[model samples]
Target chain A: MKNRKIRGAYTQYKDNQVTPEDSYWNRRDFIKNLGLSGLAAGSMSSSALMATIDRPVNSGFNTAEPLSTENVVTHYNNFYEFSTSKRKPAEMAVNFKPGNDWKVEISGEIEKPGNYTLEDILSWTRVEERIYRLRCVEAWSMVVPWQGFQLSQLINLVKPTSKAKFVAFETLESRSVFPGQKRGVLGFHVLPWPYREGLRMDEAMNPLAFLATGVYGKPLPGQNGAPLRLVVPWKYGFKSIKSIVKIRFVEQQPYNTWRKSGPREYGFYANVNPKVDHPRWSQATERRITDDSFFGTKRIDTKMFNGYGEQVASLYSGMDLARDF
Target chain B: MSYLVYAAIFRLLGADPQEEMLHQLGLWTLILLLSGLSLTPLNRIFSIPKLIQYRRMLGLYAFFYLVLHILVFFWFYLDANLAELFDEVIKRPYVTLGMLATLLMLPLVLTSTRAMQRKLGKRWKKLHQLVYLIAILGCIHFIWQSKSDLNEPLIYFIWLVSLFSIRAYFARKKAQ
Candidate 1:
């Protein structure tokens, strides 16, 4: 078995004609060989970068199960920006245009504050691929291969001031595009518009805190927060705000959208803790949504810190998760 | 009739057919229960005795759908795992209320026959009044299960309240 696996890898490497210098020329040549135009090639290569990165199972994470199919992951989403239904986000998000020339504004308590374009941000750090379990607050989960750099890298570049103790994130809000934001019969008022989320300074700087730009080896679909988004594996999926437009370094904890809309049900911290039940549902178990079958989706015990306890459990050692949650 | 059509459509094209079917079945059960309760007031307002003939059919339909809803939850959601079903009923308050509502319907359904009704005489009227309690429990179960967006449950609550208020007003007048 081992010899066969090694042989397979060797064959793959030989087929790709990989060499030390191949990394530089392979991208351009590969895209040009596909007959794509210059503009199309640039976007395709950036998204394709995710597939090129090594995904050896790192210690303290689960990679036993196969990564969920891109179809299931993309079609099933809780992006309330587009619609409330799990299926509607992918459908209605067709109208939403995540412009290629996106600019993220960094301000508040940071030494170097300015509007940085997506390209400028990409140039600041090297992107790597990480397989993480994304557990939704709604008692469902998906294992996704995310492509991005550690958020700490970006935070370091901006040089947060000593007084900055928290990091607040804000997503793009366009009423004309985001159907949920419109104030009419078609709109949903379950959550405050322009979703906001925050994390403690230590948590924000944690190696696990990632800013994902792509998924499944492609640029994020409009439904799944194109361009850039946060991915804190241990926290509930809502904490990973999508289509982030602003990153504020602040002294106080920011008001998160879910917390603001329903304080009793949603909390700012929003960690994935089975012991802490939501007001209406149990958090002990989750339905691992894959493709639907006759037997239905599988239900599994939810792990504390979403199975990243060894890495992140100490960050909240003294605080009460139940209270914070 | 519409409920069956909706269920068929959901089965054909829904992303999560089991979930959609469970929701639709539970909703129809509640709607039919409320409809059964409405027959009396509707008959009185119209001064027509013909509507009373449909009451038993509506109540039976409600019970039928309620049973199907529970079965769907057991077979699809729990995969027919009796141990987990028992655990869910004990652990979750919403599940408990739902089970209680189903259990309460059993006695009413058993005594629904003409022979059983005749044998009990006046006592049957009091026994059948359990439907009101069942309706309340059903609404509570629906409301408790909702995580957010209480609009649908809230509408059910308002409908139940309106039906009870009308019954209460008639009972007071009858007393005088």
Candidate 2:
């Protein structure tokens, strides 16, 4: 999979690829549309807000394995901002508008530190579809076709100083939009709001490091981190923070949400190593999220660095992964 | 129940059906188990001797849920991979506790009938007290398996501890 040249530039992702099982997702979207209309009546115009977050699928990366349906990918989420329950976020984040001016503040040891709109930041580089296997720390996995530009593009544009040791990513903290931040995760209010995640400067500069603008081609819906989010293929899902509003190039090891909330369980370098089992569950295997006819998710053996070790292993050559994990 | 099966059939079980099923089964089992365990304590405290009559039914229902839980795990979770099931039972300490607790429940379930209860007499009551051990095992298994947010598990743990403490209080009163 080394630098395979793109064959096609624009293959319109025909929405016709969906299965009959899409009836349920349609029902959900129908309900969401009702809510969207109510919001439109109250605030913004209907055209401005999305009824169904559908975008043309850009053909970039190729995979023999089937991609998880766009509906399931968007409907089933882990954004703790709206709710901890995977299915609830879709319904709860209906009113969550990332707004016309979503600014991502580039701070710390960067040369050109300023608050730039998401569109301004994206102008630095081009977006491409990266079909990557996202393995959650919960031992469930999904192969997502992400629309993102490499983080290196932004890093190059901003130019981090030698003092920059780490790159921290922070999510939006408006409790009004994110109901879970206002309330708690299943009434268990533990994590500090504006979820924080970071990477070593070298890790941030990795070819695989991605700042995803969309999933399944459409601009990201509120449930799946609208506007922007990080997508690090090698690390556990939490390391790839959602709905990022701040990007700081820090000198010290930055404050990460999980590492702060659960120091023993969640480490800084959350590289997907199956050998290093999570304290809660064995990472030896993961349930690949396939919308099988019977909903029978296939359990497959997890690989080192979630099958991206070839590209990312050099980043942690001598360091003990087991200890770090 | 039938609701879960219907949900699965209609493809309304969300993203991971098997995981959701397993979770539901486990939750019902824990609920039933705790409810059954509470009956005797409730009887003593409230002087409602009739409450003792329902304890056997509650225990049986809890066991049934546990059976379904195991079925879901092997059939869907491991996809009838007996080797992997054994490996999980052997490898994970939490799984080991759960399996052991399940194994121990068998004898109690076997001797639950009226004829067997009559034949065993005093020994039946003694053997049934093993529910205390099973309850403790179940609580530990639940607590151990919890990832980081121990909110739910800790609640169950506290409930179990409180019940046991109440039982101990009754025991001391009997001694006095």
Best TM-score among the predictions, by candidate number: 2
Please provide, for model 1 over A26-101, each residue's C-alpha lDDT reduced to its tens digit, 9 standing for 90 to 100: 5435644554545444455433433443333344333434455566678777887787667788888775555435
CA deviation > 4 Å runs, candidate 2 = A1-62, A182-188, B45-48, B172-176
All candidates' lDDT scores?
0.78, 0.79
| TM-score of the first chain of model 1 | 0.81
lDDT at A289 for candidate 2?
85
Error (Å) of candidate 1 at residue A11 is 29
State, as a TM-score between 0 and 1, how close model 1 is to the true structure.
0.79
Residue B127, model 1: lDDT of: 95
Clashing pairs in 1: none
Fnat per predicted structure, each in turn = 0.08, 0.31
